[model samples]
Target: MTLELSEPADVDLEAVRRVARAGEPVRLAPAALAAIGRRRAEFVAFVEAHAGDHLYGITTKHDVAARTVLDDAARAEFGRLLPPTPPSPSTLGPALPERVTRAAVLARLTDILHGTAAIRAETAARLTTLLDGPLPAVPEGGNGDPGDVVALGRLLRPAFQGTLEVGEGMALINGSPMASGVLADAVLSGRDRIARLEQVLALAAVAACLPDMHVDAQLGVLWGDPHQERVLARYRELLAGGTWPRRAYQAPVSFRSAPRVLGGVLRTLAHAQDAATTTLRAASNNPVFVGPDLRPPLGAVLSNGGYHNPLVSPTLGALAHAWADLAQLVTAQLNRLTDPPDGIAAHETEPRTSLFPMTASGWAEQARAAAAPGLVGLGRSGQTDTSTPDVLAWRRATDAGAALDALLGLLAVTATHLVTRRGDTPPPALAGLRDAVLECYPLDTPPLDVAEALDAVLAHLAAR
Candidate 1:
């Protein structure tokens, strides 16, 4: 399917997921393309009319070279030159995954289509053309030097840097689109983890005969948290018509409060999504065109706002911290459910699942350590320092989500293990999930790698 870039503001998490994970093709709408072309022409006319004027990335160089004047030859050379990107000491790792890079590439295309970047239509078209195939490797670490210019350059270098014009080079690399796209992809995947965990809860609840009062919708009104209701609503749907213990003994705190813990995580996830949405639609190019929609169009003006996206940093941190809390909650449930002095795993003995809680405990520790907010720092240029560790923050949150995925999958595996060992019957509604979980058999070490077992279960859980 083709995604048209007409109203760029309409681009959201699902769009990024489709393009990045599903490899959907992108197309700029005719109107947006024409507007981009006209804006590019108008910008050129504006520059020619004001010859000898100093432009941040056009007639003059950037950063420490800000004051350096360039003749026409130097200007042309500067335009095509992919400047050395300062090393990212804070972010150290492999290139961004292809899906994340593809998300960033798709994000950059939206900015060009916004008509504020003043890039030639051909450049934008060329970028979209390349989106049809394999994407270049973008480094995971980068200085927030007016956005991920270093990584953006590597992605664009093969077909892009050779013919860049004045200001066009900056337009290509300038902005927080990389951060935006990373957050978009992270939020999408994080939501999937949340859903999978919910399913795990469904299976566990039925297996334990978790108290109905815990999932009762009225409890949401009593709790006073707006997100609580939606979580309970889903639980109610999944648990409806499920058999419950006739005695109605209260479940342990781990079983009772899981929804509340999840409700709080949902709040934090929404916060990250709000921040991602803002960054995703941002046309945050340096030297951005001032009046592209004007009758004659105003030329570009350089400002520090293009690269100043601190909100993304803390929002990512928040997500990591949230998952850390969830990991702890999952660990508690795992412990109670495993030995089941008497809750979910009542009268159950699954020796193989003994280490599952520890695995989740370890992940919780890792995510907590990585949850520090992005550090804001001054750069070598000493000129601008709106730099936030967005790249690092994005990595932290993405890794946290993965950790949560494993923790929840392990929980699901444990629940299935006990239920099958006891030959229990779950609610009719959970029959399919039971079948899927049953397929994740032989979790013991003879042939199945625990990780592989979890992977099989996770793959099935993800499908639901």
Candidate 2:
């Protein structure tokens, strides 16, 4: 998977998803690295050729009025004059600059692809290395301003010692990197988590044995919709030949419309995936090159909000909300499973009658009894804070992350019971999926302990 800058490459959705959801590493393709190297060399050459001329960030000093042009020899010396250190601590602290440095490196790479940014090949290589390397720890405490550009400038000054020239220094430091780094990580993770969580919502409905109308009808609606048919198909593939559907017929109305609820979740996950993909491939920079030329032969460069990451924050928040919604759904499924009154059993007349002996007083009810509070608390906090955008936007995101782990615990228990009840007659898809989840992200808590808590919650649901 070599990605070439000359001809655009498919933004690796899997890579983005893995990093965002699993907190994995990010890597650039050989072609991408090679392209960046070539561009870096060209940029450095251009700087070396016109070193004496007056340019925005190159020959002349930055954050100052453009005055006289310096010769190529003096330009190198002029670049050495570091700006005065701020008297007070920066407000945003080190996080802002860490992000900016990250973004600047990315921007520089993009600019290299455009045959601009006039840096060296080694510089581009170093930038890519930095992108793929461990993110250095950034001190959080400071007192200057919210933007924190100066802090970023100071941190980047050392890393960029041999690489940056006149305008390159300003170019690297001028844009929003902190937000970019956060946004990149956030969106990438959001995409990955949403995909699985949305699927979990569907599985939760199936586990609840909800009504077929609520379950499959929603899937039908999703199938009819333009974009969701693919995801709906995946769900169908997951459920085919499973005894869960037959078991649902014996349950209450809670089992109905399960598909629709899950389908909606799938739809939302699709949106998050799309948004994340778009952001990942986007070039967020300022003073972009017009064409093949790094230093344009004529006219000033183009500068705009292309690099401003306002959309990433909101999208990240939205993805988090979707996860919260799915978590609540999972909690509801845990409620049905653990409640004895809910009566989870396959009808004797159903096709898979040989799968299990109907049992009302199984592990579900008992498990719910112990696990209910954490689930309830998570649900309440998520809903309580939804009164304003601040709650839904920020507070909910935090709550959703916690909710995901809790729900994973619940799902593990439910799947365990399903495996126990099915014996040898279980569908391969369901059996394989259960095994996969267990093997991949094993329950953080003892299944029996979590099941008991689920039992407590089930009791609460029955009381309600």
Candidate 3:
């Protein structure tokens, strides 16, 4: 299926996913074609009429070399001055996964569709076609050529070598499309993981004998937090089919605060998705053009800093922290249920269920350490080079998500242990999870064998 790209607003995470992950094609709608053409005409006229070497990236050098200017001959050579992209490092090191590359391509196309750069319709069309075939390998440890110019050039240059015109080369490279594209994938993946993890939390709550009132609707009303209300309400649905045995003491801070932590995941990821959406639609073209339309000949060549997107770092960083917080909470729940030293847990369930499941893995601590936020580089006078921290942000978020896999498996099996020892059937919401976990490690599977059983449990849960 073809996903149509029209207005800048048309580009979103879902569209990018379809084209990037599901292998769908994209079409440039006529309206976008008209907007792109109109903007290109103005930029071309400005470039052709001006002889001075002040044409932003087209005529001037990049980064600290911005002080230097190229002559008319260099500008006229048609993309000759553009730096050559480095060779693919796929054999030597890791390459960007197929989905991220496709997403970056779509992000770049959306940036151009904003009509801020003077790229030809043909350039946009070629980018559209590139998505249908084997995309170029963007290595993992990318040679951080300024603004990813080399990487973008490598992707776009194959479109046409001889006539790759002025402004087009830099336009393809400028902006935070890499950050936006990566964050888009993070948001989508994070949402799915958070959703499924919530179900696991429901199972943990039942296994731990949490009072249903802990997530009752009234708690949301007292706190005046609608997010908490919604989160608690979900717990109710998942816990309804089963019964919660009253406990002398309350559930752990993790369960008491599950609504808050889970709500935090929802809030932060929405903010991250919003940040990505804004970036996907925005034009980060330096020396951006204003057409002679409204405001009586708004035609002007404006120098601006539209390239670096600062929001990507903080929002994605916050998301990583959310995952970290969840990891800690779930770890506490798993240990509380499995560890015999916790007198409260031992009172409610069989002592034979005792085993410190948290001891089996230290993923929670690792996630906590990675939760420290990255800085958005605002270039200062003495710095060697300004840099984007999105790559680090991407790394942290990915690791944060990965740390959950084993931790969740341990929690899943431990919850099943509680359900088995207590002679209780898992509630409807937890039944499938309990069944999957026990199927991997049946009732006879010893607690000491949890290490060996984790792979099978994780595999089972993931397949669902």
* lDDT (CA) per prediction: 0.74, 0.45, 0.72
lDDT of 1 by residue, 1-464 (tens): 98888767857788898888999988888888888888888888776665477777767787768677688788888887655555444346587888888888888876786777888887888888877999876767664654777677778777776687877887887777787877887788778777777878877776566877878888999999988778898888887774445226887787788888889989988888888888888887776766535544455565557766767778888888888777777777777777645443454334454557667778777767767666776665476545667777878887777677777787787776666656666666676777786677443443336667767887887776
Q: After superposing candidate 3, which stretches have Cα over 4 Å from the reference?
A: 78-81, 84-93, 142-146, 150-163, 294-298, 341-360, 378-385, 446-453
Model 2, position 170, has a per-residue lDDT of 50
Give candidate 2's error at residue 141 in angstroms: 7.7
Across 286-405, the per-residue lDDT of candidate 3 in tens digits comes to 656666673234366566767667777787788889888788887887777766643235544443354445353478878887798887555446422566767567768877877775
lDDT of 1: 0.74
Cα miss at 393, model 3 (Å)? Answer: 0.5
For lDDT, candidate 1 versus 3, the one ahead is: 1
Least well predicted 10-residue stretch by lDDT in candidate 1: 342-351
How many clashing residue pairs are found in candidate 2?
A: 56
Model 2, 1-464: lDDT tens digits are 32223422333354433433343433455676676556555545555665565554565654333466766676776554433334334343434333323443443344444444434455555655665554444444431222224444555555675555555555555444443344454444444454454345445545555343433436556458634455455556655565654453444433343344545655665665565555545554444434335345532345454434445446546556555555554555555655443323331123122111122222233223322221111212421221112112322344454455455455544544544444423345556545544454333435344345545433322222
Error of 3 at 388 (Å): 1.4
Model 2 poorest ten-residue lDDT run: 383-392
Cα deviation of 343 in candidate 3 (Å)? 9.8
**Candidates ranked, most accurate by TM-score first:** 1, 3, 2
Weakest lDDT window of 10 consecutive positions for candidate 3: 343-352
